[model samples]
Target: MAIYFYGCVTMDGYLADSQHRIDWLHQVGSVEDTGYDDFYKKMNVTIMGKRTFEEIQNLPDVEKFYQATENYVFTHEKELKVKNYQAVEENVLDFISKIDKDKNVFVIGGNSLIAPLLDADLFDHLIIQIAPVILGKGIPLFTQSEFQRFYHLDQVRQFGQFAELVFSRKAPLDLPIS
Candidate 1:
């Protein structure tokens, strides 16, 4: 499972505004530098929380929005009907484990999903689109994680209201024999 993250963060590192809103995303101009369009093309399966999936539904051209690939949603109650979507109640790891690791898996979310993968050491890279707004208070794009490690910055690009940051997890340090 080649885990990757795709989403944006505020200037202050928050994912959404105080109301848990991300209306600014719609106003973002078309900039290929973000690599979002390309990322979508490479992904075979998408995983997201119900709330995040619902937000996508509210956007215009919902069907066309996710026409790129299959979707696997992790939700408890809501049932969504999409030709390429399957809802799973199991933990993210469990669901992720079921998929063939030979293909790339895109973990799409506001934070809930990102935090888990980061904690479990499952992600291979992160694609962060940082919006130029400081949401002093809101759901942060990266919730405080307990794990402490490093990520090598791969690339950076500036767009209209967002800057794209690509990072790959650093190699684990080799411990000396005690």
Candidate 2:
């Protein structure tokens, strides 16, 4: 199974402003202007944090938006208000490992959830769409981590004012047997 991270970030590499607001994203462009629909079609399952799920809840017809995929929200809450999404309280790694091998999992948001998978070298792909505007201070897409991982740039595309970059995890080098 392949795990993907597909989202838009500010030019400064932030997911949202300091207030946990993504109002700036709306100012740049619309989903129709981006390649979101094309990417969404390939996913069989989606995983996100509570904050991301909450943000989706605010949008109209939240049920129909993610109707195609099996949704999982990483939250401590015993149950979620949404009908389609299932609440997950276990360790992220354990939960991810249990997903069917044939499923293509898309990570909606949450740097906290992304970082751990990245550190463990489990994230297979990263598709970041960079918006032209920069927020001086905001919630970043990445945080300090103890381990370092590498990826190779596979493709780059432009959708209006946004630049989309596609990266894939680099395969580990093979050592010759003595």
Candidate 3:
């Protein structure tokens, strides 16, 4: 499957603050400023870590926040009775590997969940909008990992005070849009 990550991070590379809050991102740019609507149009399913799901649930009118075709949450819990989300306790890599190769999976963040997938080289694309402000310390976009990976810059768009950077994995993933 074509796996992609979509998030807004600070210039310093943090996804959220120490409080698990992204108010800094909102302070600098609105949802449209991040081009989330356009990005979501290319995704069939969204995969997020449990903590990230919880954070979304805490938001006002959570149901509308992630209106994707399907939602999957990676959690340690074996059972989840949530109405709209499927809980996966299985290996994230294994789970993703089994999905249809043609499908586009959007990996939502919280850093910890992104590290393993990133380190394993499972992501096909990454679209991050850099907020104007920087929080010297907070939850980072990339977690601690030993391996190194790189992506080619496909496009960069500037919107007022924000900038959207889109990168695609090299070689096989650099094909032109169909």
Best-fitting candidate, measured by lDDT?
A: 2
The residue-level lDDT of candidate 3 at 97 comes to 81
Worst 10 residues of 1 by lDDT: 24-33
* Lowest-sum lDDT 10-residue window in model 3: 169-178
> What residue runs in model 3 are displaced by over 4 Å at the alpha carbon?
78-82, 172-178
The whole-model lDDT of each prediction reads 0.76, 0.90, 0.81
Q: How accurate is candidate 1 locally (lDDT)?
A: 0.76
Q: What is the lDDT of residue 141 in candidate 3?
A: 89
Model 3 TM-score, all chains together = 0.87
Q: Best candidate per TM-score, number?
A: 2
Q: What tens digits encode model 3's per-residue C-alpha lDDT throughout 1-178?
A: 7999988888998888888888777678677655778778888888888878877776676766667658889998776555567888887888888888888999988676688888788888998878888799988888858865768999999976788889989875655555
Question: Residue 160: error of model 3 in Å?
Answer: 3.3
Clash counts for the predictions, in order: 0, 0, 0
TM-scores of all predicted structures: 0.88, 0.94, 0.87
